[model samples]
Target: MQLKKALKSLVPPSLQARIRTWKAERAIAVFEAEWRESRRNAARIQVRRPIERILLVPPDPGTLMGALGDDAMVTSVVEMARARNPEVEIEVLTGRPVASEMAVAHGLKPVEIWESPHFVRDLDALLTKRRYDAVVALGADIMDAYHDFLGSAKMIAVVDLPARRGIPSSVLGFSFNARPNPRLAAHFAGVSPDVRFRLRDEISFERFGRFSPATSELVADSAFVLTPGAVADDLGAWIDAMHADGRKVIGINVHPMLFRDATDEQIATIVQRGADALLACAETARVAWLLLPHDYRGRLGDAVCLEPIRDRVAGILGDTVRHLDGRHRASTLKAVAGRLDGVVSGRMHLAIATLGMGVPALCATYQDKFEGLYRHFGLPDWLLLSPESFLVEGTFRDALARFIQQLPELTRIVGARREAVLALSRQNFTIFDDVAQTARIGSAGQGGSPAPVQDA
Candidate 1:
């Protein structure tokens, strides 16, 4: 009998399912083992460069949650670099407005800064400029698709390498997410000649071999800021439920500029509806207003706190949304998220931060990011309100009630997920030592000499 038939004949359906799952898991384990060994062999082959003058690039650093992980990656890189070699100069290629804001806040005084008028054109020029010793592609961007085209950099570090994308041998790959996407890593390893794909525990500069501490605190504190909000469809109903429950309602507006991209009517409609809702909800309790710090170009009514959100939003958007910048925002939204018995937010990062800090937040999402994070942590019961359905007041109230009821479970789940993420981060540390040693050897090989082994 054929192997497939023989296996099927020997096992019941349920037993077969378990066996198949086990076999798949075993294959992955073996693949990773072989891949790591191959990397070890490559590390021994001889590296020719000790990287310096690194550039950090990510997609859309100015948008709210779009830039959170990217900023963390950059911060980690800076910290790692400074620790490894304090004098190693660094530069950033980012959106102009966001770069300007980040410049003063973190020690991000880049030796060179490239502000892209168009992402593609500016990115090409920035990557083509004088040869750098290394380039660190921090986040998921189309530009990272062309890392090999960045001919000047001797060493390249990527956050994640998709399955079989054919990256060059010279680049070192690192998974940026808290956990490894083992299948993706394996596929990449199979394609690239000298790639070493490893599970990185902490998203850090030192962990990735840059070894700087210049921006560590920003990263460490990033996860604590998410405040959950309502789904787009159930906003009205959620308000009613809050009132019935005698809860104070905070209305947070965290989208792109309100009126600029919209026709006057569209802008007016949103404002009018928002104002009306605030008025209607005001009867139940007070309204605390929070706007995505950079989203307001024109000041709303007196209740809105535009300055702080604008300032921080300016840092992220750089100059693309320049007219929106003012006194930098520090997110008093945090104070709100901290004290609130519950939260409803459109901003996904805010939810992550808030939940991590033991706040119960309901997400009103229009995209995959919110749902992705929610599902990643197995909290499907929380609302994933769509734009159309979010207007319904009854739906909102029901969802809020359900969310409130599940508070205890939500806390446990968030706590468990946070632990898993931290544990994965801790596991990534070993990769750091491997890469650092590889660099030391690469440096010696470039000079055509065997490195002297120093007994530690």
Candidate 2:
């Protein structure tokens, strides 16, 4: 590990990114070829009616703890499924033995993605034995090969195999970058028509339409349905105290990914300037700041990245600046976010949570996903900040001050579109229902036997 870190330190950030992209593209190409060949020989499947069993594949590998955004997606789907059918057996595919707290709380069974040495044979055996009524893949930005190419390929295979068998299958609401990986796009273009695809934003919908127009539909992200849970007593008390003191409370989420390309000195400089800016904004605006951490993936977590800035700001401002220093669930954090007047978040889900509560958010944009999210609130180009621009001195403070100034209007806009956004988010599950019903009709027409469908 030390040697690997040393080697990584020697390479420039731009070149490292290029190398990673090349590797992902090559692996995707190889996987696509093998997958196409397998589909050519695969037999069709027949699904039974009154959908009782569901197989949900999340974007993350192990427990749903790596990223809150991924966890919110899984949680929303499970909750919505149960609300529709209390007895629906929902099993989540995980790479680890243990499931997340949210999964256990929701009574979701965790099934290992790889249970044997033979990937294809094992999945086939499991599916045939379990006899699932439907298969849903949470394609949250991974289908584009920009995040995890291997995870994207695995999700596609899981959905494709079951889909070829005539079972209800869909890739749940997901996003595509401005320029998606060509190999991945081509692969989706040729996927079986029986598989349903839902895009979360206009940008992704417009881009995906060029390839799979017939299969893709525009829908809002499922995270919009996540309900707020209770906040920690201490955090709640702090917010109440701030309000009692006639101070406007603002929340901020900082992550290391925003500074992934910076040197150590550059990171320190950026953090120092960011703290100075926050202090300045607080002094002028009479705002008390809440340092919120959304992701908890070891070194990459927002908590690890925000500690230094938190210390610096708190040392000077005392109780006016506080850091939420513990492991908290996504819903709990959402509840805390709801108490804030506005939020500036490096993580998209944190922004989603705040906005869902009718609070204004300035998203620190990455991977081009935030544009569509902002569009959902009817305020495109109003509250967005690029990492490149944020790294410069004064940019962070300038953006924060401006965001604070526009909070009232932004909150009004978010409130006006809140119901519409929730309605669109509900459409994700409705699409699954529509496909399942259509599959049922098709099954009944053929005497409840597997329909003979051509392989892609």
Candidate 3:
């Protein structure tokens, strides 16, 4: 629209009116030709690189940052896949209109965004649009469209989370029922012969393996592969100030789910409880707290969902607690998180962003995803499962007390574990490399390190 508008404004009004009429007629003709034959004989441009053009499909769609840490984690799949072959052209295929701000932060710039997501919508159109040697799904769970897209791409569906018993009734096969549904079972069988699995956690591996007990390699969340970038100016200034005071900064991520799902009164209770714990810990220990809201949603389109809670914490803690919400990219958030002394959050990916960088974190919940990841990080004791009720149980203060007192050990453990996980995460790329090298989907003989398309 900007390009068209600018071009039009440069022409005289009288000439432009006539030009528009003719341009529309010509555009229709071009559109018809493009529809009929644009991609028909389009030569499959191949190269010697392990992979060529890659399509990344996220499980659900929203502005990437709305999913917060999830955006960084999913995009890490693109980063991981690209690591196998840096020159590979990458595109994000999702329902939301992708903005490049998130991708740019990771030193990766997507070539294009295929509309919508796979499954019921754009899967077929996108597959037919380009010959993708590889298609990777970022979300943990296995969806119904898993096999279809996997078979269409002639590769694997990377399962992140497993279909636990009775929890998710939505995914086709794994219902609360005694037996797996036959139709979904048939769909499950559609996985291509050449496919591979990079299951994020053991539970996902175990549950998915029940169907195809073949070789599903267990792995940690892809977020571990993301390296932090330089912190932004404003956040950097705050960190520097705290550093001048000789105070260690701890990131406090309050997930929107904490309040969005609760009533006003419940929200106040949660805020008071969380703020109380943070203030006690901060004032007593002489540490600064950075309020990081991983998810920004609800009223304003770009607003972080935890504004109310952030406001509450800020009101009490004053300048000691500052909120990081607006326009901060995932990479920026991760960079900020990497600087934190510790973290307490309800979100998984935020914890991943922090913990993956060797920062000690006490998650608000001990869920399956965290458990699966901590096993790989070798810091299983670092998390507290579902700590929402911890305040009421009078366990919040004591638990945090323990986390604070043992900060040195926690830091050492996380730093070593992050190094180990990063090493292991690199191996996750081998599956894509093997599949692409053997499949050899693109045109041949073009080598010598194809221009670095990893990022702009």
Evaluated with lDDT, which candidate comes out highest? 2
Tens digits of per-residue lDDT for model 3, 378-450: 6756456464564384466667767777778889888776776776566455545543232322111111211
lDDT of each residue in 1-456, candidate 1, tens digit only: 599898778788899899877765554354334333332332121211333455544433343123443443344455555555577666655445656456546655442233222232333334344334444443332212232222111112221111112211222213232222222321332233223322122232232223211111102222332232333333344445555665544434334222234344443444444344433443343333333332233543211333333343445333222122233222433433544455555555456545555566676664333544554356674467654333444554455456656656776776677655434333322222232222322110121121221111
Q: For each candidate, give its TM-score against the true structure.
A: 0.47, 0.84, 0.68
Clash pairs, candidate 2, are 44-165, 45-165
Q: Score candidate 2 by TM-score against the native.
A: 0.84
Q: Which stretches of candidate 2 lie over 4 Å from their true place?
A: 1-50, 98-106, 114-117, 147-150, 380-382, 435-456
C-alpha RMSD of each candidate structure in angstroms: 17.3, 5.9, 13.0
Model 3 worst lDDT run, 10 consecutive residues: 161-170
| lDDT agreement with native, every candidate | 0.38, 0.75, 0.53
> What tens-digit string does per-residue lDDT give for candidate 2 at 237-316?
98999999988899988776776555666567657766888888987787899889898877677765578888888877
lDDT of 2 at 74: 85
Model 3: residues with Cα > 4 Å off, grouped in runs:
1-48, 61-66, 81-87, 96-129, 142-184, 258-260, 299-316, 380-382, 390-393, 435-456
Can you give the lDDT of residue 341 in candidate 3?
83
Ranking by lDDT: 2, 3, 1
